[model samples]
Target: MLTILDKYILKRYLATFVTMLAMFVPIGIIVDVSEKINFMIENKVPFLKIAVYYYHFTIYFANNLFPIFLFLSIIWFTSKLANNTEIIAILSSGISFTRFLRPYIIGATLVSIFVLIMGFFVVPVSSEGFNNFRYTYLRTNGQQAMRGDNTDVYRQINDTDFLYVNSYNASSKTAFNFSLEKFDKDKMVSKITASRIQWNPADSTYTMYDYKKRTVGALGDVIVREPEKKTKFGFELEDLTPVIYIAETLTLDKLTAFIDKERARGSSNINIYMVVLYKKFSVPISAFILTIIAVSVSAMKRRGGMGMNLTIGIAIAFGFVFFDKVFGVIAEKTTFSPFIAVWFPNFIFGILAIFLLRNAKR
Candidate 1:
């Protein structure tokens, strides 16, 4: 059931959130545009269109960063209420202090759900447009890759059948490098290494350079062979997409898909993808947890008052960020489960929220 208080609080939070967004986004645009003003003028870009670009860019930046403003808004508005004795008045009216939290929880939950949806589905679609705009006109040249010159990556060419490298070239495909490792059941059965690999576009077959092939028979006998001619090998582009995407950029589905893709490809870089996917889910939930923690920390009026709450909130945000960052570094070096690595900070702070909520009640 919706209550009048819920409406009041929601209105207040959204109003303030939007105002802060309105101010901060324009400032960001002004700063960015100032640096590129000469570039725009040199291109003879019309002033009006330039202003429109800034407006769109600002909206995009502001939308991406809205949750942080939402958090701060709730904290600032609630803190103001407590400082002015408004929250105390509400609580002293024989309503349980916990009950006084209903409106806040409702508001937070609604916003959190909306933000999560926007983050997962909506934002990625928007990114295509945003990124395209940036690259097409704004000269984001680093988006493209150079063959043979970029970092080398390995990928499965197809269902346990072959492996490939599109371009080991950090610079050019001429000096390509790739390898194939065969596994039977849980055991490594054979291996092949190549110095330079070439892709055949018409035939969809890969060519190996300075390559050696080895085969392990069922009974453990090993055979090695070398051929002077470029042999047509079965391989496809799907195998290389994961590596290219990873080397290029990572998004939600892209990062998650890379986990399975890498394992299938027999690449050892699974840890990085694991961390990314875990953090995607974990970061949003932490925002919800932080809101709860803030409510608990700032509920009551005391000598420390709102300033105490602000300091504590800032400290807690920092600590949570620190915890997440440190855990991530450890997760990278060690074999820690990705979920635990990413979610532990949220778990720790959720406990802190519960503790503070109890104390605030007393």
Candidate 2:
């Protein structure tokens, strides 16, 4: 399962990764502290909390940069080996480039696995702490647990026919215009429109005042009368939190749920949400593909030294970033599928990796 060359390459790469992390962590902390220093001082934030937030921010940044690290590490290690003619010696010994690639691929696989597991699984668990730490420390604190106001956007929270107001003003929570739409077997059964909605913290039910109602028939007709007022929608208020969570920040499952809810209500424009969902998964995997491409490009040091490879690496990284954003903007604005937008960069680079790897044989 483990070859000597593989172990050597891994050891080299691991040393590079550790060096990068060692240098990066303190730099990361300093940069984060600098960025947030004024906010913390102004907000009277505690030192301990600021320290924790810095760690969280560093983790997020490192996770994002993992692919670049993979690329650079492989490039530097392989380039040094190539400079010393070590790779030539290995090749002269009858080791094909394909055989050499085994170790690199294995190392990349392990890194990719580690990155994915941490990004999707671990970071989310710590997001609450990280975000709260920042929010608490920042000089300007936004309103939390918004109590009330009039005229708010409502989300049909779940399949149970409950709606959540995005932000209700405390001044007049009662007159807020939010409602719950009830459906049965793909037919609109009843609509509760509220002028003012108030959440009962004791029991979690929302009471709407000065509201109205409408019932629709199965055969595309009105089943019953005009809207009514003072309707108390009996559902848990906190169930609406997921709906109110902003589009980009929502996790995969929450976003899927939101999408389903919106679709059921015949929402036509969901391109932005669709783009977010696609980007979430594609962003991490892009690292793997980009890493492969970077290694392939640098491994053949027939011409320039490390400087040339570094320049090439930076260019490729920016190209990936640029195209990724362009596709997202296009997909969000047009009818282009989000899946295409998200995966296009990866596909292009993956092809590049294959081509470069083939050409870079010693």
Which candidate leads in TM-score?
A: 2
Question: Residue by residue across 1-362, what tens digits does model 1's lDDT show?
Answer: 76776678667766776777777787888787787665555556566656656655664576556645666666777888888888888777787877777777776776667666665665544544443333324422332222332344565444555565434322122324567777766676777777766656666666666677778777665755554336565444434433422422345666567567667766555666677566656766766687777777766666987787778777776777788889987776688876788889989988988888888899
lDDT of 2 by residue, 141-170 (tens): 554322231124454544646463544432
Q: After best superposition, candidate 1 residue 335: deviation in angstroms? A: 1.7
Candidate 2 Cα misplacement greater than 4 A, ranges: 133-255, 266-269
Regions more than 4 Å wrong, model 1: 26-67, 126-258, 302-308
Question: What total of clashing residue pairs does each candidate reach?
Answer: 12, 14
Candidate 1 has its poorest 10 consecutive residues by lDDT at: 140-149
TM-scores vs. true structure, each candidate:
0.65, 0.71
Alpha carbon deviation, residue 19, candidate 1 (Å): 3.5
lDDT for 19 (candidate 1): 79
Per-model lDDT: 0.63, 0.64
